[model samples]
Target: MKIKSAEFARGVTGNDYSTQDNLPQIAFLGRSNAGKSSVINSLTGRKNLVHSSKTPGKTIEANFFCINNLFYLLDFPGYGFAMRGVQERNKMVKRIFWYLEFTNARPKVIFLIIDAKVGLTDLDLEMLEIIKQNNHKVVIVANKVDKLPQTKRKDKILSIVSQAKGLEVLEYSAKTHEGKENIFKIIEDLVK
Candidate 1:
């Protein structure tokens, strides 16, 4: 789908915050530095529409962006960062869960991004379990494939697909815009 217009709606910390006019949503979930922002920017063809950082855990809020005035792209804060103290980290984790659990608005699909170079981590597996339990339709996007060796890409993709069971897995690189067509096609099918 060609993005006629795109812009950040707001950054929210909790579910109590009201959303804009009703629209279908495609949510993103991943650990810090997993390239969530970059992927969003690339998909919307809006360079730097969402701020990205080299530092992990830079996105602390669940930001929403409207796409073509048709649906929302919810950019959630990345988890699994060690910079915060135990209490702070625990609080953030709780808030994230609260938002997911309490949201009345269901998303069309949830994109769970995994860093291609790193494969899957323990935290990622844990989050995957949660997403699966919720019965949310998920599309696993293995990000940063541009950093991986060509030989390893196929193996890594297979590994992710195996781990994800029935969910479709797509390799992606925000830097090079690789695998964007497949990703968008899946989104269109899901949200249409």
Candidate 2:
């Protein structure tokens, strides 16, 4: 799971997708500002591979990254943000759904990232249902665990798990590098 080399492939929006090579894709998805970029950066040991924006809803495109020349890593636009206008949000929504539901290069696995401290949201639950409906294998990543105090950590994780319906949940912290290797291993297994 050690990533020898990684490169940005493309940024996709609207009805478009990344160039077709049939590389097994692992998609990362979550709520806006849910730490999707940070988790990818942390997992790959590439600090800036994915941009961690200070502004919510900044990542409006689906970014594709070639991982180790072995597979593709997809950074999907975060859902459930209110910062965008109706038309813009509709486009984003359509783009993401189209990629997930209609793309030729379906992801081998979906990393559903959630803010650990914030626990799970109704939207996240909806995404989980979508993953199930599509029969896509998913790994729920609870990121930003570094922000949770020790005493509340267990309860917070439990809260996230309660909503996951028995899907595997990994507690993670980009700042602390916690659960990074485990995430990488999962991706490697899926792609290989």
Candidate 3:
């Protein structure tokens, strides 16, 4: 599953281009500042590929990146950013829901990224429930593992796994590229 080519396809706020594309989509979803963009950049091994921001909730639309010309890596706007206006937050949430429930571009799998130290927030749990209700295949990615001490990493991952119920939780570090290969493998399987 080596990435031979990756490029920004488009960003959509509604059912236009997104629904028209038949390419298999791999969705990346998470809370604001959860490192979704960073993980994408890390996986592609291209710095600035996704343009991670220091500010939370900067992504306003679903951005699609074409991967290896085989499928699309959909980078969705982060959810539950308290700093944003209530109306804006709600709009973003509704957009995500629309994509999940109504769009024709069904993702092959959803990668729910989370901060390893923060574990699963209430918002994440809610999102997971909705995603499951929609019957989408999902994988939980515990990003920023490098921030935690080596001794605490396993315990944190275990805690996340427990909280995630039976869902697969992959320990990841966008900074160190740990668990990148495993994620690639999952993507490979799904895209195939």
Candidate 4:
């Protein structure tokens, strides 16, 4: 599935426009600086589709992007940013949970992005547990694989897969666009 046109729809902080349209939603989530925005930009074939920052916790709200006018790709705020205040972090996490649990715009599938070099952190594992409890279909995306040495890439992916249990974990590199087609295929299948 090719994305012919992609544009920013809106930035949602609550249960408002996200559910108003009733379009299928695909959520992108990860720890701070795990390259969620970069993966989205790579998948869309748009360099600046979603602003990526070097600083962690820059994406404070859930930004929605319309793809091919068929569905919305929701880029959520990254979790586990130590620099942020406790109150702010709690609020952000609450909002994410609210969207996942109470909102009508529950995503068709969630792409849980993680830094391949770092493997799965404690925060990612916690988020995964909550997501599973909510009964959401989730795919673990091991992003930034290009940074790993070729010899170690396979091993790293294997480690993540084993740690993820039965969940499907795709190898990805936003910089090199590796695994972009596989991700597109997953989205196509889920949206259909």
The TM-score values for the models, in the order shown, are: 0.94, 0.94, 0.96, 0.96
Candidate 2, superposed: residue stretches over 4 Å from native: none
Query: How many clashes in candidate 4?
Result: 0
lDDT of 4: 0.90
lDDT of 4 at 103: 77
lDDT string for model 2 (1-192, tens) is: 777998999888666664667788889999999999888888788999998898889777789888888888888888887768777766776677777787777788899999998877887887777778888899999999989999999998997888788999999998899998888788767777
Candidate 4 positional error at 29, Å: 0.6
Q: In order, what is each prediction's RMSD in angstroms? A: 1.4, 1.3, 1.2, 1.1
Q: lDDT of all the models against the reference? A: 0.83, 0.84, 0.90, 0.90
- The residue pairs that clash in candidate 1, if any, are none
- The 10-residue segment with the lowest total lDDT in model 4: 13-22
Off by over 4 Å in 4: none
Residue 175, model 3: Cα distance from true site in angstroms: 0.6
Candidate number with the higher TM-score (2 or 4):
4
The Cα error of candidate 4 at residue 47, in Å, is: 0.7
Question: Candidates 2 and 3: which is better by TM-score?
Answer: 3
Deviation from native of the Cα of residue 24 in model 3, angstroms = 0.4
lDDT string for model 4 (47-67, tens) is: 999999999998987999999
